[model samples]
Target: MLGFFKRDKNKIAKDGEDHTVDSMDLLGEKAETTGKEVKTKLHFPPNVEIGQEERYYYQFLNNELPLLKENQISLSGIEVHSAEDGTVSVKAFLRNSLPKGVRIAEPITLLLLGPDEDVLARQEFNLTGLGELPAESSTPWVYVFNAKNVRVKEIPQTDWKLAFELKKAKGPHTLDLEESWEKSLADTDKEKLEQLVKTIKPPKPGEVNFMGIQSRLDDAGALHVTLLIRNGSEKNVKLEQLPLNVEDASGEVVAKGAFKMEALEIKANTSKPWTFIFPKELVLKEDADLSKWKAYVPQG
Candidate 1:
């Protein structure tokens, strides 16, 4: 037979005030506390056990640190950001009115996944030296850590999963994040867009136009992209320098090739499709199980 474990209420009050009582049980016993308009909170110590999806809360008994009458628990949100240096920044908010005795086992953990949900990176943090917080306020805690061989991790086609744990037994844990990049839209495609614009007919009015493009299906499952370049001008335009570039979804260069049309004579309204065979290595592997490949302007 197991016995009930009861805790005594701790009080925090201004000078002299009327007192009330409330009781709380740890495993399964009823505790009591005495105070007027008492507010309770609970907090987990840094050594408390936490899961991949939970948070810790604090409670008050009468006016003291350890709540003997009630147990209050809640969840907190986690935010993760990826940096250009192949590192990640993690941030979480801690409540001010946390119980002094409550313990936390783990701070945070990150799981990196491949295109098919295959885990490629896993990391952990041992949160340290967290004490009492200010009244009705939250403190933002952050950590910046590097990932090993992040080149493969930066492939952009890969998928990632993140998890967090608040406590091993009691839980209000949550895992969430807002992904952001420091670079701008133009910066994302500056190189490739530059190369692509170079292929355009010198910005001459109606001198050249991007007609259409398609991929040629080869037997070996290789891709051959065909781009149409049209001479819409009345003059015999010399297609000497055909600037072209190709990129994958994550602003990464995948393939690049160019062609030169003979001093072609286009009285008006003429077009040609240049075929480009994508290298197998540059394409996403079958093992990745990606249904479609995204396109970006190829780099020179």
Candidate 2:
């Protein structure tokens, strides 16, 4: 019952192609391609009950756009709006080529990049609002990157691109960036995260691993331990609770605790860091050698 205007296939940017989007571009259906840009106006069905904006989008997806092949999904950035406060919003389309309908209810990351493929902003979103997507159909949404979300010191006003920054979406050791942690990362911290992926071992199937990064003793003698929680499983997992043991270089239990979590999602094949504080009462040894340390689930 939805509709969209047909998109010019040639107009869609492919890899190594120019992807700058602007209002000047035509959104017409292609009837005959005789080696020229054609803006064929197609009549709309009277039965469509959606808004004019949605009607145009459906026209783009159903008639103007080419049929999607097997297992192919396409995302196109149609518009970009930048605010004086450095906040940006991008309107994009998500299309699927599957034979059957598809539904997604998970957290997804959106990456905005420059013409040279440098990252500009990274933001996380929930797919609950996407609803159900029919096969060979597209849905449009606006992704906003507020000042806190933008990562670069300079933002090119034009010629920007959009992409999904999935945990497993990108190949090995590229960037283990999740928006929550990414915002707090310093230049040195980012370099460390990039390097860690290369050296971090792959987690076993259906398992999550917590690798120790560093630990410190506060003035009050509480131990704060930072760890990288890496997920190597084929599926995304959520953690609701955590019972941990912190061991020293000599395999001595220096810190131990059970902590509650807010249903944290450890996306497939991504590594994220978190810190755990062991109160002075939970610290078994005040003088534990923490030069080399590790964390794990305490065996019964």
Candidate 3:
């Protein structure tokens, strides 16, 4: 895992007050509908652990959306409508399962998928701009995707679905470091690595991003380069075999190698910093520019 990671700054939920806010209150200021609304009610399984008083307060919400499942964030009653402004309007009830209230300000991407699961369009939204979300309750909201984000010019009237681009983890790590790397790392290098984590943006789901740490031309005619590999997906990835081409500032290949991964597993939502050795025999250019270089997969 990327050990020298920055601390997550997500705001915590507030506690210590009894309040009586309607389930539909969060949606008033946003998700504005110009009449002609087609809303649907969802049925959910009951969680007996909910106390009576809290249950009573949520009774109205329960009739519309199922009780928020334990440790799960789900969307229900997704409806698509034509906007008066000529954009696509998507309304859905976002159900929060966390026991405590939370605020969502992160850049969230919503995808419009076709009936065959093809992505029609995607747009990013910040929920904090809309409003705060209560704990274990379903809140309704409308997302509008503009023309640029929409791929297909002719929109499909039916059989389309709206969903989150990627699922978020329940409790994300606050600089989660793998055990082995933490032990042998030096203080100065650790600080630099931490800064790298903060400086380099993370990769999207299912993709791996690499940042060069150090590149030097060895006296033995080899090029040794250290890299930080980031995996931003929700599922663990095992590198079976990775073939990479090392290119310098001129976009000229300096070194190339195929690695045999004996055992390299990058956990979900983690980054791993590693050093790859391009042997002297494999080094194609000895005088390649090391100041600005990149490592990428070679194309056939």
The most accurate candidate by lDDT is 2
Model 1 residue 147 CA deviation in Å: 67
Worst 10 residues of 1 by lDDT: 1-10
TM per prediction: 0.24, 0.44, 0.45
What lDDT does model 2 reach?
0.65
Put down candidate 3 lDDT per residue, 1-300, tens digits, no spaces: 111112123422111111122222322222223333222232222222434543343344446443432444555434555544457666555665544455665777778777677887889887764455555556545567886787775556556666665543333311335566789888787787777676666677677667687889877887888777787777677787889899999889999999887667777766777778889989998789877899887778
Clashes of 2: 12
What is the lDDT, from 0 to 100, of the residue 109 in candidate 2? 72
TM-score of 3: 0.45
Collision count of model 1 = 52
Clash totals, every prediction = 52, 12, 1
Compared with the true structure, the alpha-carbon lDDT of candidate 1 equals: 0.38
Cα deviation at 254, candidate 1, in Å, is 1.8
The lDDT of each candidate is: 0.38, 0.65, 0.60
Model 2 stretches with alpha carbons more than 4 Å out: 1-50, 57-67, 153-158, 169-300
Task: Encode model 1's per-residue lDDT on 161-266: one tens digit a residue.
Answer: 3333222342211111112211432554444444443455432445565533455445665556655455545444555655454543444444554545554333
Off by over 4 Å in 3: 1-179
